[model samples]
Target: MKYIKLAAVVVAASISGCATILSEDVATVNVATSTGKKIDITIDGQNYTVPGVVKLEKDGQSKIISTNDADCASSTAMNRKVEGVFWVNLLSGGLFGSTTDSATDAMWTYDDYVTISCK
Candidate 1:
């Protein structure tokens, strides 16, 4: 019975938040404009719009932003972060957790939102 309990604990720990424990190769960034207008963005040559979300790989690609608003100006690159569950998995010995996270691109996360100035 003790062994079963221990095994259950190990399995639970290993599978917990597996998506967020291993992978972070992509991120979905929510973009917005200062004037509440839609804006255009180019990341590594891929075009996107603002007041919307874009899913991007975290492989060092940077956002090159633009807006139709003549007044609006510059913007910053989107941010990336390791998921909080990453540490938990690490501490739990991960085992299969790390593998799942890596395969599913859940080990990392991106900032939920960003804004661009058009003035």
Candidate 2:
């Protein structure tokens, strides 16, 4: 029984990373406009309207948020940062778990909201 319990714990630790268990591969970000008017923005080459939500990958890459419309004021980028859960796992010496998170790109995250100034 003791050995079985130990094995179970090892299996769980190997399979579940802190970040992987707590985070997701996709994240939704809220896009809005300062003037509360609907503005068009481009992300990952796809167009979307402000005052909406966009689903983005949790990959560790910076995404360019831009506008083609002349009415919008400026563009911005969403930067990826390492998830805090991954650091916690690392600190806890969960090497396999942290490695799993890193391999699956679950260790990264982006801002939850973005606001663009529109004229």
lDDT of each: 0.67, 0.85
In candidate 2 the C-alpha lDDT for residue 84 amounts to 82
Where does model 1 exceed 4 Å of error?
1-17, 20-25, 60-69, 95-106
What shift in Å separates residue 13 of candidate 1 from its native position after superposition?
10
Each candidate's TM vs. the true structure? 0.60, 0.82
lDDT of 1 by residue, 5-91 (tens): 999997787675655534455777777877787767666668887779887875533455554445666546665566777667767
- Return the lDDT, model 2, position 86: 95
Query: In lDDT terms, how accurate is model 2?
Result: 0.85
Q: Which ten residues in a row have the lowest lDDT in candidate 2?
A: 68-77
Top-lDDT candidate index: 2
Question: Model 2: per-residue lDDT, tens digit, 2-112?
Answer: 999999988887767889998878978998877788877888878887789999887778888898767776678788888889999988888889999999899998888
TM-score of 2: 0.82
